[model samples]
Structures are given as C-alpha cells and as structure tokens.
Target: MSKQTQETGGAPKWSGSFGFIMAAAGSAVGMGNLWRFPMLVGESGGGAFVLVYLICIFLVGIPLIIAEISIGRAGGKDAFGSYKALNSKWGGVGILAVITSFIGLSYYAVLGGWVLRYIFVSVTGLPKSSEEFFVSFTSSTGSQIIYYLVFMIITVAIVVMGIQKGIEKSCKVMMPLLIVCLIVIVIRSCTLPGAGEGIRFFLKPDFSKLTPGVFLSALGQVFFSLSLGTGATITYGAYLGKDQNIPKSAASIAFFDTIVAMIAGFAILPAVFAFGFSPESGPSLMFQTLPAVFDEMTGGKIFGVVFFVLVLFAAISTSIAFLEVVVSFAVNTFKVSRAKASVISAALITCLGIPCALSFGIWSDIKIAGRTFFDLGDYLVSNVSLPIGGILACIFIGWVWKSKNAEKEVTNNGRISFKLVNVWSVLIKFILPIVILIIFITSNPWIMNLFK
Candidate 1:
C-alpha cells in the first residue's frame, strides 16, 4: 500500500496504435470476462446467451466504441471536454459517464481487494475448505479495509504517472501476463476428468433456452464486459494520434475482448464440471468454486498461485482504466497536475468505497431494496447510470455531432470507405439507443429476478 510512483504532470499521448490497443484491450478484459462472463454463460443457458452476446458486440458494442472514441479524438480532451467541444449542452452526458465510472471503481476496488487476498493466500496454499475461508475473510472488516486500501493505493500510483508511461506501459506488461496465466489454466483445466461436459456446455448452442430475459442478460454482458457507456474509451481515445484508424482500432479491441471472455469460459467452466460442481453457480462461482478445483490438482499450490496472480493482473488493468477516466477529467477540467488529480480521485473513491468494503463485513445488515452497499453501487453503475450515459452519448453523436462530422475521425480523412460509416450512424441513432433503453428498463432486480 505504501509503494508509490513518481508523477509527471501533463496530458500525455499514447505512443502509437499498439499502445492504444493494449490499453483499450486491457480495459475491456477484466473480472467481467473472467468471473461474471462464465457465470452468465451458465445462468443464461450455455451457447444461446453467447450467440446473443456476440451479436450484441457487433451490432451494439463496436458502434458505441467507434462513436465514443471519435468524440475523444475529435475533441482531443477528456470525456466532458470532448462533449463540450462538440456542443456545450452535451457536456453533461460526459459528466454522467465519469460519474458512472467513478461509482464502478469504488466497489470495483473492493472486489479487487478480494482478488488480492486470494492471490496472497493462494501463494501460501489454500485451506482444506476455501468456502469457509471466503465466508470468514469477507466478514473480517479490518482485513477487508486493509486489502481495499492497498488495492486503491496501487491504482492511484499507476494513474499518477500519466498515460504513455503509466497506463500503456502497465497494460503492455499485465495483458501478456494475464494471457499466459490463462493459457496455463486452460491447459490444466481442460485435462481434468469429465472436463468435456463443461466444454460442450460452453461451446454447443442450445436455442431452447433462449428467452426475452436472456436477450437482456446478453445485452447487459456486452455493455459491462466491453467497458462501454463509461467514457473510458473516450478518455483513452483522447490520447490517440490523428492518423490512428478509429473504426479498425475499435473493431480490434472488441475482437480481443470477446476472445478473452470465451477463453475465460474455457478456463473456468471446465474446472467447475471436472470438480463435480454445478455450472449455474452465480457471481460467487469464481471465488468459491475455483479453490476446490485447484486444490485437487497435482502441484495445485503452484497453479493456484498462478491463477490468482492472473486474476490480479486483470483486476489492476481494469481498475487503471476506470481510475484513469476520472483523473483525465480532473486534469483537463481543473487544470491540475496528474499527481494532484490522482491524489484527489483516489481519496474520493476510497472514501466512497468504504461502505462497499464494509458491506461484506460490518455493514452487511445495512440494505436498500434488499441489496447491500456493494451490490447497490454495482447495480447503479452497471444497470442505471451506464445505460443512461450510453443513450445520451448515442443521441449526442448521432443527432448533434452528426455522422458527417464524427465519421471524419473514424475514416482518418477518407482513408476508409463511407459505407460502414452510414451503418454505424444508423446503429447509434436508432438500434443502439433502443437496445440500451431496453436494458435500462429491464435491469431492475425486481424484473430480472422474475426471469431467473
């Protein structure tokens, strides 16, 4: 928690397309891919939900990414700055996006704390029963606070270094490490006895499970998994060079993001089935089930260490992206140094996150609408704020920014064709907004629980 990085103050640019891709992909591939993606696959009925999710990625995700990034590159500023540059009235939409991301980062750090705790214990060796440990550890208020503080401190340290050296550099390192660790996990998990059943359930399509609610789940997954609706891509895109092809780069990021989610499915579900566990286990599936699976392996202690380390890498990369957006806003909007902005953002996020961290332990009894503080923050961001931000963003770019002006950035001054531009234009204007609105309406737990 005490370790720190020397800060250099400025609005730094990304080195090139490669740096941009790594940072964007690292942001896209997070715990959503590793933890929630697999659980959704099981809950939404295997490949049916995956099919809808992939459709959503192309129809919804790619178009939104291109739009947001175009806003950033054209304006050459933070999310709100970008919107203000386009039209002053739309600036509030950017503020909404930043707020949503900040809310997510608050509870997300606490989850990162959980990931860090697992990494720590996995090195020493998990106990005979990890379920018991998860229960005890989450209920220990002091330990939770310590881990959360350490996790937030590390996030702030990285953000203080600015863009190229800080985010791009860290992502370039962590993304590769995460992929390598996942490869090891995949190889080990696929070899487990009865692993084939899990693979079949993951890859084989079963359309009979399709329902209206499953479509909502798929849409929500695409939204959360790609880090859309958060101004992250817009903030990250503000560093893009004029020559970078926005459409092509956005497409590439989505491809890698979907690939990671599927790879995580291979890594987790196979192990779950092999260990005689139910695949339909919810969010706790990753934390509660994985340890038992790891414990039974030959040299499991070593693999457990690698598994949690891999997760830690994902957590850090994702948190960096979330924190970076707020930092960008502060520096650009307030004319503060990166270090100053990072310090302020970290302090604010840490204070807001205390209730979420305590939710698991001391504040468990404090509830709103039958959800704890962590769950409430998570739902507000993922369910309500994000969707509204996305809807407003789509309206701004599609109607106000207009395809004629916005498409300029995507094509890099006519380097690419205009056919795809019109397609993207139609999507953000009509299809994307409508779909996001559908998710916003149906995301209420009262509604979602009915389908479940």
Candidate 2:
C-alpha cells in the first residue's frame, strides 16, 4: 500500500480482527442473502438447493474469498492495484470485479429503495392488501425514483466519512442489530397457527427435484450471497491487518452470513405457511406476503418497522462495500481525494440506477433481450461477470501466481497451520473453474429456458 493512500484516510488494515470479521460478514449478509435466498430455496426445492448451496459456499465461496483477500493483503492495494502489482494484465481481473460491483450497486440501490418505501408504508397502515399495495407502489414512477435517490443519498453519506469511521463502525452496529431483528421476527413468525407446516417444508428436502437449474441457482446464490467475485472481499482484504488469518476470517464470515440467511428463511417461511400462502412466492414474498403476515399479528406495526429497518441495515452495509471498491480504485488509480471519488462514484451509480428504478414503472415496457433494465443488470452481474470473475481469480491465484505465495497470507506467514494450503490450491486450480463454467453456461437465458 502507498503512503499517499494511508495519508488520505485510507488505512491499509482494519482496526482489529473483530472489526474485519464483522465488516466482512456485513458485506456478505446483504439483501440477496436475506430476501433472495429463502425464495430461491423455495423455488428450487428446499433441502436439495440448500445442501448444494452449503457445499458451494465452502468449496467455491470460501476458497475464492480467501484468495481474493489474500491477494489484496499481499499487495496492500485496491482491487485493481492488488492485481496490477502482480502483473499488468492481471489487473483485468480486478477491473472485472469493480465493473461487476459498479453495475451491481446500481440496481441494488433500486431494490433498497423498494425496501425503504415499504418501511414507510408498513407503519402508515395500508388500506389495501399487501399484494395490491405493492402493485400500486411499484406502478408509480415518481415514488420509485424518489425512494431510489433517497437510498443512494444515504449510501453516499456513509462512504464519504472514510472506512474506520464509516464502514467498520456501521457494520459493528448494524450486523448485531440485524441479527437480533431477524431472530425476533423468526420467533414471532414460528408461533403462528400451522407454522409447523412451513417449518417442515423448509427442513425437508426433495432431492428428486435436483436438476442442472437447481445446481446453477445454488451456485449463483453462493456467489451473490457471499459477495464473492465482486472485488468486495479483495478491497476489504486490503484493509486487513498483516497478522490476521485469511482462511479463518473467510470461514467465519461465510458461517455467520449463512446463519443470517437461514434465520431469514425461518423468519419468512413459517409466517407464509401459517397464513396458507405458497412458500414459492418468489421475489414478492418479502414485499407482498410478509407485510400481510405482520399485519395480522398483534403489535404488527412495530414488527413491520423493525423488519424493514433490519432490511435497510443489510442494504446499507452492502452499498458501503460496493462504493468502497470503486472509491478505492479511484483514489489509487486517479490520485483523487476519498471525498471526490466517493461523490463521483455515488453520482455515477445514481445516474445508472435511474433506469433500474424506473423499470417497474415508466420503463416497464422497455426491454433488452426480453428483460427489463433491472433484470438485465441482475443477469449481467450474477450470471456473467461474477462467474467469470471468480473463475479468473481462481486461475490467477492457483496457477498463474502459484498457491504457495497465497499460502503465506492464509497462514499469517507460518503462524497458522499450512496444512490446508495444498487442498485449497488444488480446488482453485482444478475444481472451481470447471464448476463455475458449468454454472455460467446454465445461468444463461437460453440454457435456462431449455431446462424449463
């Protein structure tokens, strides 16, 4: 890391191990893991999808996370700078991660805006049913764009304050709070009438439903949920202390993040089942079904507020990471102030997000390759950029840079056990790329349509 970067409020390491773990977990446990995971589990046949997803997390997510972080910590630089230190062409890997994160945050903010708006109305008492309320709200152009802007503004404010004061502090506060909120919601939801049926549904696996699609869905979820292949871990790793164990930190982050996702499933599945709704309600399960579930309970408004507040915390934590990747790149690459980079990045994302925010309303009819702007962005990041980025990072680390070099970072320069280093290397070199390539191919619309 350059002294110039340190001089400009960009410390090369986190304040402590705990802070790094919390910040990393906060990055992984975002809106996708919370809201999307359960939906995916439901649609993909609960047990089988989850089983594959957990395996994917350990094999793909953990290894890639360790590799990305180790790369950053080794070079002590931004995502691109980290790779650029190794070789100029390797910077392309970092560039892909940044581009993925940039495009990812644009649509991600739009989703955050949706949650923010839902939070407001959850307290106001909707005269209409939850589904109708969601339909009406999403159909309005001005409301959608306004909420999106509001969410982006909040994101920008946090990033501008720098890492320690902003990112780490926020995560330390938000992660625990988010966990508590989810636990409370889960407790309440499980006690509802016939909630046991939903619990059974979630716990039970239909292995017969396993297909190429399920595997792909689970793999993609692991990638998106763990915040892998997005350069976030790489950028965050740059802020990691030299003495920290990359493997342990990566495992802890993945473990805690998986817990949050599971808790979210418990929070929603039982409530929907108790209310006699289908578990496979897809994306609308959160905005449509859960609101009505809360409304039926005593002190529902309070629960509603807490639920959406939990969601906002998750969203903010993720947005901070996405912005940090870009900000770090700008400060190091362009030699700009953190404030300038933060502002420029935020503004760029806001402008790019306008189409995504509008896709539900004014831009509903607009389509690229038979998908809306929001869906298109999601596909590009989740299916295309992410898988390619992960495979490339693995190839760069396992073969190009040689895993022995990364072994030092994982082992803390021989302080920790170096036993698993060989296994990690082999997986990165032989297993991950082939698996990701399969996922990448299956995730395509044409391929997916065939499976359907």
Angstrom error at residue 332, model 1: 1.3
Q: What clash count goes with each model? A: 0, 1
Distance from true position, residue 236, model 2, in Å?
0.2
* RMSD, one per candidate, in order: 4.3, 3.0
Estimate every model's Cα lDDT from 0 to 1.
0.84, 0.84
Those runs of model 1 whose alpha carbons end farther than 4 Å from true positions after fitting are: 1-11, 43-45, 280-282, 445-452
* Deviation (Å) of 72 in candidate 1: 0.9
Residue by residue across 1-452, what tens digits does model 2's lDDT show?
21122322455557677778888888888877766787778667787778888998888888888898999887678889999987677998899889988999999998899889878878987779988888788878888889988998888888888777788888999999999999999998899889888877776788877897788778777877887888899999988877677788889999989999989989988888887876554457778877887788778888888999999999888888888999999999999998999999989988889999888888999999999999999889988898888889889988888888878778877987756788898998899999888878777758768877
Worst 10-residue lDDT window, candidate 1: 1-10
- Tens-place lDDT per residue, model 1, 1-452, is 11112222344578778778889988888887887787778667788778888888988889988988999888788888989988988889889878987998999999899988988777777764878898999999899999999999999888888787789889988888888899898999899889998898787777877888788888888887888888899998888877677888888899988888888889988888988887655447768788777777787778888988888888898899999889889988898888999999989999999999999888999999989989999889987888888888888888898877887778877876646788888898888889888888787657667778
